[model samples]
Target chain A: MTPFDTRGLKRRRFKDKIFTSIVWGLTFSCLLVVFIILFYIFKKGIGSINWALFTQGPKPVGELGGGISNAIVGSLMVVVVAALFAIPMGVSVGIYLADNRGKKWAERVAIAVDVLQGIPSIVIGIVIYIWIVKPVGSFSSLSGSVALAIMMLPPIIKNTEETLVLIPNTLKEASLGLGASYFKTTMKILLPTGIGGIFGGCIIGIARITGEVAPLLFTAFGNPAMVKSIFKPVDTVPKVIFAYASSPYDDWRRIAWGGSLILVVFIILLNAIIKLFERKWKVQF
Target chain B: MKNRWRILENKIFVRWLSISAILTMVLLLMFFLTLLVSSWPAIKANGFSFLWSKNWDPVNSHFGMLPFLIGTLITSFLALLISAPFSIAAALFLGEFYPKGVIPNIFRNVIDLLAAIPSVVYGFWGLYTIAPLISHLQQKMHLQASGLGIFTASIVLSIMLIPYSVSLIRQVISMTPTPLKEAAYALGSTRREVITKVIIPSNISGISAGFLLSLGRALGETMAVTILIGNAPELPHSIFSPSYTMASVIANEFTEAVDEIHTGSLIEIGLLLFVVTTIINLIGRLIIKRAIA
Candidate 1:
């Protein structure tokens, strides 16, 4: 290398320092923001959390030792119901699109899924609130679960179908040649093969729906206390947190942090589960 | 004869799954159609004037969506601008530079965790945490008390989009041919030069596509924008001025929308966002297909 060109590689130490500092600054600030958020939430929210917050109802005015039992039940109910509605339907549809790729309808269905995937969850909530809950004259968990189910469908369908499609056709033909029916072949061969991705899809679908507050806001109609049934109005953590945090009472605000922490934990745990499943079951199609 | 009936059962199973798939397709269509239909009233009533009208005064009968539209675009665009360079660099580093070791896995999982954080928590955290940091910057600069505005929202929104953009760009950069990099290095180019010329040029479309996808994400984002930017529907004179987004407007006011027009206008805002995203995705799909082929 020429000395002139080699000198081009060398610069003032200040320039090097500046470049180094900029890179460090960006990453460090990003890290700091994340750390600070968690710190604040834990600082404000953890003190109010206790076993009583789990066993009893939400705290009333000047009251203490009540629990998020209602919000917990409500959140769990909507999450489970949404999954039940979304998982089977989304997976089966994904299977058809992937396994039956040669069919005319599959391409059309794929486009349709993309459109569905694009629509916002809040819009879904608003539509159901207008058409379903408005006409039904009752705000119920059933409607909220349905909205959440609709919200959950596209992600599960997209990921599960994509995962299944990544499985080579040879496996399907081999299963078919063994006298396995299409349904049985899909069940035993395709689904199991893509089980990790399917699990990931389910985790994503669950995370997407569980945190949905806008849809539930209009349909589920947040009830601060414990819920009795899926057919009735109940409190979920997001809705509760939204309302309680903004209210006049400090206690409600404190509970909002607790609920926020709970919600964050649930989502993180779901994602962690997906990561574990992905590693444990790495069967390739 | 027994085998024929068994075949019939198998046929039924496949067909039934097909029907279920078809049902899902139908439901997806219904969502689009319903959003369009619900949003049509405001669109029809306003005509092209809706896009041009600036004032968003819901108190008066006159309500326009220009400011929200601009706010959404600006905040999201700003986010894409600030996040894109770092995201691309990070993606390349992860895909082509980072050692294939525990560190890569750790970094990858951290990215994944960022993606998993719930929108509401992000929102609240943006409000209480990020907003203050932003406002603190103003204090140090001796700016006004109200510096929590579009720029703040844009930065936070960019933070929200980082994982998606970085992962996508990383995958794209990694997918480039090894020979391309080797050729660049053989030419005696530095690593930076190789990335800028050989690596990025090869994957320019994908990187552009990532930004577009993220732009769409920033546009649709509601919770994060709501918390960081003080929700005043206006075209800010500068980035530090308050503004509202289309999604945040609907979110904040949907419940309290007293009249049908009010609700309809908000839904119309949603419809606009939907159309915008759909077009972006469709164009992206076409580009990706062309790029691959």
Candidate 2:
């Protein structure tokens, strides 16, 4: 029997050790950056929170000790309104894409959806501003919602399509075989079966729009006071945070940190809820 | 007669539902139409010079997109360059190095949470934390810096993209045929050797797709870039110099612009950004399709 090449094996071992260590180091550093950023945001933001931080509208430039109550409300309004528009359309599109699979129109719609997702949030704001703001002759919450709805569409569509795709074709076919009309089958069987996943998508969409500030730039335009109505200007958490963060005042900066903290906490909560629901109510084939 | 009536009802309902599906395409068409119409004034006035001209003067009525365009390219490419290695390594760690268990699942969850954190938060973090660090580095290196510039923006963008590209690359790496890796192992290959010689080369297309997807995202990224990019319209003299992206310019100026021409010019930049990102995404999809096939 030939002797094994111990030198070659040693070299290979050394090389493997070096490469593995490098990869592990890279992974550690990447995770460390995430932790550090999370830690830093929480550290800065947590200290700035208080009862006043969530109760009152912003104070004037010279004043101190105010909250972004208006922004909080405005964010809820915009996101809820956006969800109303996006959910139905997104789900419908997703259903169409999944049901039609290889059809030419389905392919086209899929491509369009991908392109829509690629469009910048700022560009969507511009388009929606031209569509709604120019016609209305003012920045309004409705315009902001429309822009966010556009932003929300791709995720909902993608997630819904993915979830629906996972459902066995037999379930759909069996429903059709039972003399249920296409719409009825979709409404009763398909959507219900995919509800958990679709709801998860909706949550993701809402979370996505909640922190968006770019698309609201000209559409919602930040309001210092409370939102008067959907037809008027409004403040959102991210917008408020952005405006305040860039300002020269130390108080505003502190408020920005507080707002950041709240926004981050909200997102973290949403993610946790989604994860919990996914674990509890995952749809099985 | 009763059966015919019921069939007609089904047909109508199906057709109606189908319209909603077709509306996705309609929405895309409308988006493009509005962007084109809004951008027409600037397109007509500036002609081809709008693309190449460096001056973006609202006072003089000249709106050149070249600087911001270059800025966007610089930052996106720089982000990809900096983050791609780390993302590949991270993906390799998850897909190859670690066993599928609690520790890897925890790491995956952390990455997902990182991705879910909003861009504005990244922007805020950039403004407060990263920019200062960048400026400190600038001071140490004896270079002019504002901490808010291309370098800082690219750094923030790289961080934002790491989670994205890592998840995508990890998916691709995991999808690689297990038999190929097994074959490599049977040949007395080590884990690192298997990954390098068998896994990555075979999944190169998917890895490239991941990179392109992240690039497309980095191009359109608004809040993070706006907060860190310094938003100067000047052509970037150095990575440390303040610059603007097409998205940031539109975000910063769209609300406050005084003229139709100004708005039109901003919309033109939006059009440019839209076209660029669309092309990038299309290419990414094509590559991904091939990879999957």
Counted clashes in each candidate structure: 2, 0
lDDT of 1 by residue, B101-210 (tens): 88767776776667776667677766666677778887897777565789888877887888888777777777788898999889866666676688789888987887
Best by TM-score: 2
- Looking only at chain B, model 1 earns a TM-score of 0.92
All predictions: root-mean-square deviation over Cα?
3.0, 1.9
The fraction of reference interface contacts (C-alpha pairs within 8 A across chains A and B) present in each candidate is: 0.34, 0.78
Scored against the native two-chain complex, candidate 1 gets a DockQ of 0.45
What TM-score does model 2 achieve against the real structure? Answer: 0.96
Lowest lDDT 10-residue stretch of candidate 1 chain B: B284-293
Interface RMSD of 2: 1.5
Least lDDT summed over 10 consecutive residues: which range in candidate 2 chain A?
A: A276-285
List, residue by residue over A1-285, the lDDT tens digit for candidate 1. 554764555653445455445544554455555566667777877887878767777766787557688888898998898899989988988888887676788878877776666666677777787778878888889889999998788888878887988888889899999998887788788888888888888888998788778778778877866777887888888877766654677777777788888887788888888888877875553
Q: Compared with the true structure, what per-residue lDDT tens digits does model 2 show for residues A172-280?
A: 8999999988877888888999888888888988888899999999899888888869999899999988887778999998988999889988998998888887877
Model 2 chain B is weakest, by summed lDDT over 10 consecutive residues, at B12-21
TM-score of each: 0.91, 0.96
Q: On a 0 to 100 scale, what is the lDDT of residue B281 in model 1?
A: 75
